[model samples]
Target: MDLAQFKEDVIQYSKQIGIDKIGFASPDVFTEMKERLRTQQELGYQSGFEKGSIEERTEPKLHVPESKSIISIALAYPSKLKDAPRSTREERRGLFCRASWGEDYHDVLNERLYRLASYLKERYPDLQFRSMVDTGELPDRAVAERAGIGFTGKNTNLITSEFGSYVYLGEMITNIPFAPDEPVEDSCGDCNICVDACPTGALIQGGQLNAQKCIAFLTQTKDFLPDEYRGVIGNRLYGCDTCQTVCPKNKKKDFHNHPEMEPDPEKVKPKLKPLLSISNREFKETYGKMSGSWRGKKPIQRNAILALAHFKDVTAVDELVRLMKEDPRPVIRGTAAWALGKIGDWQGKEAIESAQMKETDEQVLDEMRKGLEFFTENV
Candidate 1:
């Protein structure tokens, strides 16, 4: 088999099938990444969402026996929303990070990988390949870095020359040995904008992230948000983009190439008040298609309550009062109580006082007490 010719053919076909960037890499052990992962684990900097053991994550051959090469692919997503809705005083809005703005990239990238695999299978009838998107055991960023898709930025995202750091990455491990591509040179020299701009200071010195302190990770948690991060999370409902948005490398990099990747501004940046009471079915029907909804409506609703507090949206006080008085979920009810206190309205205080008598949950009662204390302190 002329492996070089096959590699060329695969690259050409990849472009034809809408893959923005493609690169090949040997399936060698990712020693550096393994060490980094170990360090992150030791420091408790990892988000609990990581899927695999360190060995499985760093070694591609374990995932696919006889894996000789990895093919990394990237699809650029839009950074700027074309027609974003305004967040008025009466109608405050919350934001889903850029990665979750459009259709779930997991599905989109997986479809592209399936097509590429089919094309390769036609020529090599005995080919064995394992493809993975974001959730796969193999680290997509490490694979893409080795494959020359992009250099890893200080913000820990793959920064492609053509698409900046806004690209979604996925990879395929195959038995075929394809010549590897040269990695792009690291280019974040003397730039600390992302670290400096992080609201919670999650980005530690030397480009490392403390995921526990990251607003992106914090917003996804189902539990009550810590007091320190509540104000920092701001209007974010799902994920945080402070690091990416502040990167100089991503300057003016917005791609609307794929129709499926274009964001519906209203959906991604919905009014906060409506989100407080959105039914599960309606939440699913509206945001289920986006990557942000994967954690379900609870987190989003919780964040929406926090967002209303961030904006001090007095108009949302009635809805918040209703949530505190009647919501089934303790987390939602407690968060609403906290938000109402933050909003500091007379009705909110009155509702909290009323609910305090009826609230049985210890946490909810504590939140109600905290809510009333806001007015007490002010007085």
Candidate 2:
């Protein structure tokens, strides 16, 4: 088999199958990333969503014993939503980040990887290959960087020349010894836009991130959002894009390449009030297809309450009151209490005081006291 010609064929086939960018990388142990992971662990900065131990994550040979090379692919997603719905004063809306705008990217990228694997199998017959998306043990960004797909940016995202940081990445580890491509020649060049723009200051000096403090990570958590970040979270329902949106590299880089990635304005930016009461069946039928809903409706509902507080949406006061008094989940009830306090309306305060009488949970009682204190402080 002509390995050189086969490499070219694979590149062309990847393009034909909707892969925006593809690159080859040698599968040696990721020495530098291993140290960085250790540092992040030591600092207690990890999101706890990480799938594997540091050794398993950095060592490709352990994952696929015969792994000789990794193939990294990037698919650009649209940055700007077309004909987006307006968030009216009467009915404010919450937004899902651009990354979760369409069908779950994990599904989309996995499908493409499977196709690539099948094509390679037809040619090499017995080639050993393993494909992975974001959830996999292997770090997709590190793989993309080594594969020369893009450069790691200050926002901790891979920024490709053609697509900027608005791209979904996936990889396949194979025994085939494809020649590695050169890393992209790009850097932030003293530009601290993403770092400076981070609301919670999650971006440490240089390129490291404190995931525990990141709003993107915070929005996905099932617990109550910290008081410091509640105001900063604004109307974001899932994920945060402030870091990427402020980067100059992503300017005018919107690409509507895949039909599957198109955002449904109503679904991605739905009315905040409706989200608070959305039934499990309704939430699943509407948002389950999107990646943002993976944490289920709890986080989104909690964020929606905060968003209403952010807007000071007097219209949502009744719904917030109901959730505070009747919701089964303590996190939801506690968050609703906090939002009512933040909104600072007479009825919201009254509701909190009434719930305080019946609330038995210590956390819920604490939240109710905090809610009442808002009015006390005002006087």
Candidate 3:
């Protein structure tokens, strides 16, 4: 097929197969992105990211050594819900992002990309191709922007005209040359609403993000919650969506009506009480296919405790006290102690006194004492 005819056919077919938007980018876009990765690594913005993301982001060529043209595709995820839950209150009814509300997108989108690659391969027997969703070394957003898919927003998410920023990106790197698309102009135009709306200062300045400061990173992390980020965490049990919710571009999309992306009824806003009771087996079974499940239940449970503490719910004080004294995880105990103090009731005080008397871990004891002082002295 001729180059122009091939481009038009492939682009049309991509839309028919459920991809919302498609763009063709040249390999040269990687040059500036390479420098940005190196700078971020040097400044320690990536200290906690998996070691592989650092290596891969720095080297896109690793995915397709001789890649000449890249096709970027976007799939819309959901954002609406029947109800929104408070930070600590887990309810049967709640709102969940559209992206995570359905069957795993990796399996769905990768299968689509593979089919596209296979079709092209059959036509050109000697064609070379490499495809990836969110899992690989290539900067998917950058490729998308360069290919005229959309502009990159200040929140570091890719935004398209049709899907807004509520889309997931995937790429197909190929040897056969296709005409590259034009890079879309930035549409943010002095709108700092997203940056100002961030509960955490993750959107450090404009399009830059300090991943360490991002609530999304904090909720998903397996390590101890950083003391500095606790208050800013608010009720976000997983990733924070405040900035995205405030974006004007996102406001134009009809998330509830998008059938491809639907929220899981169980996860919309899980109650803290039930979350505390979740067994490892139940957690795995319920969340096994979720994007939030990557870190296991420990982080979710810890975040639940933190959220309860943030709400300062007195009814949860008793449970927090029990968890402080008996919970197996040190992180959970520390957060429980903090929550008890936040409650500041007679039961909360008594729980703190009992925990402080028996707690052996210096860190736990210290947090317990602080929890006690926060209630008594602050009261």
Candidate 4:
């Protein structure tokens, strides 16, 4: 097989099948990334969501033993929401970040990767390859960078020339020795915009991230949110976009190349009040298809309760009170109490005091006291 001609053919086929950008990379062990990840682990900055040990993550050959090359693909997602509903005084809305706006990118990108594999298999019937999305052990940004798809920005995203940072990334590791493409030139010199713009200071000075402090990571946790990040998260229901939205490379770079990649404005930016009481069946029916729903409705509901407090919507006082008093989950009950504390409405305050009488959980009781204390002091 003339590998060069076949690679061009593969690139053309990727364009035909909706892959926005594709690049080839040599399957060499990622030496630099291994060191950075070691430093990240030493600093206790890991998100705990990482699948494998440092070696499994950086060694492409471990994922596919015969891997001689890798194929990295990028599919651009829309940044600006078209005809998005306004967050008003009466009925405020919470937002899912741009990455979660469309269908679960995992499904979309994995499907595209499967198709690319199928095209390759048509000729090289015995080719050994493995495809991976975010859940895979491989570090996607590192793969994309080596494949010449994009450069890793200080915000830790693959910022492609054509699509900016608003792109979904996935990769395929195979034994085929496809010639590698040169990585995109680094254009982010002296740009501290994304790092400075991070609300929770999650972005460290040297482009490293402390996942514990990242709002995007914080929003996905099922437990009660840490006190400091509650205000910083604002009305985000799923993920935070502060870093990416502020990046100069991403300005006016929204791409609508794929139909499935478009967001349902109402769903992604839904009203916060109803979300607090949404039944499990209803929650699944509405948001189940989106990638943001993978963590289930608990985190979203907790964030929605907090979003109500962010807006200080007195109209949601009753619902917040209901959650504080009657919710079974301590995280939800406690988070509602915290929101009530933030809102400081009479009904919300009274509800917290009443709930404390029957609340047996020590943690919930502590949250209840915090709520009642909101009125005693200036805060």
Candidate 5:
């Protein structure tokens, strides 16, 4: 099969299969990025997730073995509607990010990529290929950047001049070799909109993100959240998009109006109270199909309680008191106690007094004392 014609067919098939952007790249485009991933991993900037698999992520050949070319595909999931009303307390419960409010993209993108891969197989019966969304050991964004689909932006998201960073990336690693395109020139010139908008200082430098400080990753991790990040968590129950929201490149693009990617009207910006009361069974049923549920109900529930604490809702004090005593997760119990204290209600004082006496971990006990102090100072 002719390489040029094969490349064109791949692009056409991706479009027919419903991908919005398609491009190609050589494995070598990863030279600098491989080093960066390694350095980031060593410094613990990868949040312990990259897991010494840096070599595989940097070398496509290690993944595909005979991979001579990579065809990168992008699918857009833009927010078409203006954010719904979240001004009232009741409306803020169970809120999910726009990308997660619908069916999971892993299912959607995999179904499309499999079809495209099958087409490639039928066309060139001897070709070997593998397709993946974000699940594989491959460095997806690096491959996408090399393919000229986009450039890595200061926010650490790949932003295309056309689709911005709102697009989801998937790729096909193949034995067939096509001439690769040069990487696109970055257009984020002197702009720090994403940097300035970050509430957690996750954007440390241009094109660099410390995932440890990233609210997005923090919300996704199943482990206990570090103490310093609690106050800045605010009302976000899942991922943080403040950087993307403020980018000029993202602002000018047409609203992402895909029906399948629409944010649930009930979830866009959640109220804190009802969210706190959701049962584990309810959490599984509501968020099981969504990507934000990767960390499960505990993190989202914890985030809600912390957001309530941040808001200092005196009305939530009784609920916090109950959670402080009843929740099994020490972190959750500690946060509930902290919120109750921040609210400084008479109920909070009782809850803090009870938790301080019963709590075993030094951290939880310390939080209990802090809650007691918050109430004592305010009382």
Candidate 6:
């Protein structure tokens, strides 16, 4: 079997299976990424959600013994929502970022990789490969960059010439040695847009991100969001897209290639009030398929309360009061109280004062006080 011909066939097959981009790369250690990871760790820049130690993450060979090459894949998602639902003053909405706009990307990419693996296995029964999506120990961006899928942008996103950075990346480490493609050689140059535009200044520098300060990471956290970033996240429910939206490279880069990648505008941009009271089953049925739901509804609900506060939606005051008084989770109760304060509704102020009398949790009581203080500060 001609290896070159086989590689060509694989590329064609990937396109047929709706893979937007595909490339091959050597399984050598990612030296530059290793140093960057080390630096990020030392600076306390890590997200804490990272899957593995620095060594395991940068070395592709650790996950796949006898790995000869890696196959990187990218699937472009819709950058703009079609017929998006409007967040009216009477009924405001919270947004999940474009990355979570459609069905869970991990499942979509895993299916693509599985199909590719099945095809390869049929032709070469001894094909040894380990597939990985975003959760894998192997760094997807490093592999994508090495495979010539795209260049790493200043925001630390993989920027493809065709799809920009609105793409989902996944990879497979295989024993078959495939010739690598040339890397894209474009730079952000003098553009400090994304770095400067970060809501929490999480970009620190160009490519270095302090995830702790990142609104995207903060939205996924189950605990109470820090006070400073409460207003920074704005209406975002899960994930932050400020950096991606500000990128010049991503201008007019919307791709609706796969039907599954298309977002239901109402679902992705659901009304904030509804989310506050969505039962477990309703939340599952409504958003279970989206990637943003992975952290479950706690964080999303907390963010929803914050979103209501962001809008100063007096319309949601009753719902926020209910959550503040009756929610089972302390984080939910406390965050709702804080949001009630931020919203500055007279009714919310009264609700917080009333709840404060019966609230036993110190944190929730503190939040109630903060909420009440908002009125005093204005007065």
Per-model TM values vs. the true structure: 0.98, 0.99, 0.91, 0.98, 0.93, 0.98
| lDDT: worst 10-residue window of model 6 | 178-187
**Clashes (candidate 2):** 0
Stretches off by above 4 angstroms in model 1 are: none
Q: How many residue pairs clash in each candidate?
A: 0, 0, 4, 0, 5, 0
Q: Give a tens-digit lDDT track for model 1, residues 206-271.
A: 458899999989999999998899988989999988888888888899998899999999999998
Q: Summarize candidate 6's per-residue lDDT along 56-85 as a digit string, tens digits.
A: 998888888888999999999999988988
Find the 10 residues in a row with the least total lDDT in model 5: 86-95
Per-residue C-alpha lDDT of model 5 across residues 125-144, encoded as one tens digit per residue: 87788887787767678889
Query: Measured by TM-score, how close is model 2 to the native structure?
Result: 0.99
lDDT of each: 0.92, 0.94, 0.76, 0.91, 0.77, 0.91
User: How close to the true structure is residue 362 of candidate 4, measured as C-alpha lDDT?
Assistant: 88
RMSD for all candidates, in order, please: 0.9, 0.8, 2.5, 1.0, 2.1, 1.0
lDDT of 2 by residue, 298-372 (tens): 999999999999998889999999999889999999989988988889999989988888999998888888888
Clashing pairs in 4: none
Error of 6 at 230 (Å): 0.6
**Residue-wise C-alpha lDDT for candidate 3, range 1-379, written one tens digit per residue:** 5988988888888877777788898766466776777777787787364436644664546667777788888888777655555543433222223456665677777988988887778777778888888766677788788889999999888988887888888988888789899998999999999899987777888888888888877888876687788877766677878888899998857554345456566575677777777898998787777676777888888888877777766667667777888998888898888777766777877877877777788878878877888876875
lDDT of 5 at 367: 75
Give residue 13's error in model 6 in angstroms. 1.0
* Model 1 TM-score (2 dp): 0.98
Name the better of 1 and 5 by TM-score: 1
Better of 4 and 6 by lDDT: 6
